[model samples]
Target: MTQQTSGEMRIEKDSLGEIAVPAGHLWGAQTQRSIECFPIGTARFVWRRPVIRAFGILKKSAAIANGELGQLPADKVAMIVKAAQSVIDGDVDEEFPLVVFQTGSGTQSNMNANEVIANLAIRNAGGKLGSKTPINPNDDVNRGQSSNDTFPTAMHIAIVEEISRDLFPAVTQLRDTFERKGRQFDDVVMVGRTHLQDATPVTLQQVFSGWVAQLDEALAAITATLPALYALAIGGTAVGTGINAHPRFGDVTAAKIAAETGHAFISAPNKFAALSAHDAVANTSGAIRTLAGALMKIANDVRWYACGPRAGFNEITIPENEPGSSIMPGKINPTQCEALTMVAVQVFGNDAAVAFAGSQGNFQLNVFKPVMLHNVLESTMLISDACRAFDTFCAKGIEPNRAKIETNLKNSLMLVTALNPHIGYEKSAKIALLAHKEGSSLKEAALNLGFVTEQEFDAWVIPADMTHPLPE
Candidate 1:
């Protein structure tokens, strides 16, 4: 086998230093040019490794399918499958360094994986690296695939693996924490606010229950979209034509992926539709955005509720990890809650980016591959981190300020909730307004209005019973 010298191919320099690409690989010129053209930063896709590894799985499965159908030589298929298996098992990653950003419809990344796996197989078989004699990138490694189908298919598979492995579990932890908190605070009564003003009296349990409900809905949305992502687009090479691939390539590849990743993956019913449409990813991003919105609402409420031990409505006390203000001597702020809120906002923004990328498909493919992966991975990581942080730093240590809560409850003339069923809405409103205007208690305002005797008022106006219907 003839070996090409490093100087025989184009070289590109970027933040990761120089990468030498051989002329035989489809990615050589484009990756070289992209490195120089998009020298924006070291901002490469975070899930690139998993996606590339998934490509190796697809390649191996494709080879197995081809050989089973008698399309490739048995010995050659075995060698390629062996190499691809090494990659599937994470035996090689250093050689597949082409950024997820590429112009040849992800052909560069596809070839990067193919070249790396092929070379690894050759080296393992006692041949030199980059030797195209026995194992070649196109003829052997990429035996039955193309970037058009493989990239999106691998992306979907990788994201499903990530969500099942990481994102969903973290969210479950947060949900369980909220549930426990709800039960713990079941009887602790506090004033509930709407529009940032006291509206009625409610137990801290109800407030925590709201958070739990949001998390529950978010988890449902995320889990429901996993099936959509599990549908693979393999065998739809270049333009979903299955050009050179066996008829059963898609089904066989999907089964291999499911076995390899321990997920219930399947081939898309319409390879053409799958290759041309990114609706699966967009749906996934929509679920993520919904979760982000929920997280934002929960985090914002937590931060505001824990706002001040002195100036703000200090209903709940958050843990103090660091000094809140450098100048303020004794102020403790909701830093963890604030971090969660910020991450939620970033995830929302990422959803917008993903939506835009998903909508910009031209004819057969969307060129916004890098951006789509970027936003999805970013949202995943941020959601994971924020959920964990909120659980550990905020929810776990959070304590309802019983004294402050009772004080606010007593002082809030909005305790008119107790009178709603007794004296009717008009009289209750009049009493609340008079109390607020005259700086008097509900008892005083009611006595002045001749609404009820002191004994009857005391018997009927129960703050605890106002939050829910009285027990039968």
Candidate 2:
């Protein structure tokens, strides 16, 4: 007797012959074969929620297009639409049990979605599971579609959606918070460091404004990648010829997607290039990597500025979210900055993976779609979450240490830089060195050296005037 004889599993046939699938499952033999064959559980569907939802959206749009084009029966189209809706709404997310490691073309994941939608449609039609009566997973649910086109199409969908729905908002939040803090700390001034050495007096406004500018440029870079993402390869079945697919399939599907998403999605002008190379995906990752670079600098600046309550720069103070040390009492650290910087490092690693995977694949079809999209989506989601957390817990709560700022500003020997244009560079350097050597103030050193007397020193070394240029 077969496992089906026990009533716990059901026997179904595919190209590989009979396979036992759990009777309770909405998937058929194909999905069961994938489950048994590729047991890679790391990059599972659970973590790839965006890709899975994109699959549902793709299927629903395809079914509607197929029905409208007189490709499938109306009843079957209705059944597929309803079943795919469950996938889109996440009502039947458990049915899709595949990993990104299965088939680099993502054929198995496509099959998994096909089978789940098929069985669900079949059941809804009052037919037995795996019947293939009401809907055939390949012939009906995946009509006019190929893993070659669908996987990348879904990749674009998931990426664009995630960027719009999550990444963009999170980044904007951080940028807005930094801008607000910049204005709030506009009046505060402190010693600026260059090469980790004191350079001159800088306003908190200048420091925070620099961070805001980085964020703004990053936002623009990420936004610039969207137009490429909007172009998709839906109609290019198998080898970009649209052999079995209707000629209007790609255009219609993209239109439907655009209607459903309100994004300007379009059919790729060259389906061959879309399937053969992942230039768009790689470019998008490159943009995100650039954003990671900016974020790393900003986060490092925050932590360094808020370095110590006693020994370090201590020009700013961040919110104490939790006890930073297990052994020390009342210890708080810049945990958010640490988390954000770590996220930046991870994004850097993910971008490398994406760039590498996107570069692979032969003439007709790219076999590295799954891994590339996985890394891209992972990076986007991580950046989104990290930005939100960092902004809420850290950036919004940054407060300038007025006493520390004053002390550091007063003690900075670099204020003598203002004397350069007035007394020339050599005299200013002499005063700075003498001040540092004797632990004396710039005023006292200049007076002892007789560079310009008390009145000249006071007029030339004005801290506020040093930040802005004076008429030569």
Candidate of highest TM-score: 2
C-alpha lDDT of all candidate models, in order: 0.78, 0.88
Q: What are the per-residue Cα lDDT tens digits for candidate 1 across 1-472?
A: 1124455574533346666766444233334545545455455654565665677777887777778777778877888888888777776654555554456366667766766666666766887555554777777667677888888887887788778877998999999998898899898988888888888888888998998998898889988988888888887877787887778888887887788788988988878777777888888988999998999899888888887768888888888888878898876778887788889888888889889888888787777766676678778878987898888888898889988988989888788767777789999999999999999998899999998789978887777877887778
* Residue 462 displacement (Å), model 2: 1.8
User: Using lDDT as the measure, which candidate wins?
Assistant: 2
Candidate 1 Cα outliers beyond 4 Å, as residue runs: 1-38, 470-472
Where in model 2 is the C-alpha error above 4 Å? 1-7
Give per-residue CA lDDT, model 2, range 355-397, as digits (tens).
9888887989889888888888888999999999999999999
TM-score of model 1 vs. true structure: 0.91
